[model samples]
Target: MDVDFRSGCPIAATLDLVGDRWTLVILRDMLNGKSRYSHFLDSPERITTNVLADRLAKMEAAGLVTATLYSKRPPRREYRLTAKGRDLRPTVQAMCRWANTHIPGTWTPPADFMADKPG
Candidate 1:
């Protein structure tokens, strides 16, 4: 998909791909080790199957995630973070930290989640 940038700003460019509420959540799930489609469905946020499928496809197209065949009989797949996806770790971590400090009910993300290594 051709991204028509509104400006040359880097933030605007990044937002063009991941500004939506669900995209970041999907990325966070991948970071947290939810590799299978079923695992994503089990998230507490309860993302609909259709939306999850769409976001996963889009992320794949954008080089963020890659789906590999894990089950042949059921034709199931598991996703992994590409280097581009791992690059979003800091952005996700910053958002989590901000929420933990500013949002009254928000809990801090685990230390490992913010670690450099992908789970």
Candidate 2:
């Protein structure tokens, strides 16, 4: 991914990579053990197929996830987070914490999920 960083700021550069609307959500789904394409489609946010495809490709290009071919006839692949991607666990957890604290009606995440140590 030949990214043009908007600035030298860490947050801005980080956002340049994963700041998009669907990236974090997809990361959250992966952290929650959703790896297959169909599993991602089952997410509550209802991400469209095209968007999902684009995100997965971009993530793979960015080295956050690895796509392994699981089926030859159907040409299906399974995605797994790399160590770089797993490092975002705390970020996702922090978001969950903020939401549960400040956003009314937000569902509290499972205890295990909230307590899991970042890789």
Top TM-score hit: 2
What are the C-alpha RMSDs, in order, of all predicted structures? 1.6, 1.5
Model 2, which residues run further than 4 Å from truth?
A: none
Instruction: Assess each prediction's global lDDT (C-alpha) against the native.
Output: 0.88, 0.92
* TM-score list, all predictions: 0.90, 0.95
* Tens-digit per-residue lDDT, 62-91, candidate 2: 889999999999899999999999999998
In model 2, the clashing pairs are none
Residue 82 of model 2, lDDT score: 97
Candidate 1 lDDT, 1-86, residue by residue in tens: 55577788999989988887688998988899889999999988999999999988888988899999989998999999999998
| Candidate 1: residue pairs that collide | none
State, as a TM-score between 0 and 1, how close model 2 is to the true structure. Answer: 0.95
Deviation in angstroms for 82 in model 2? 0.2
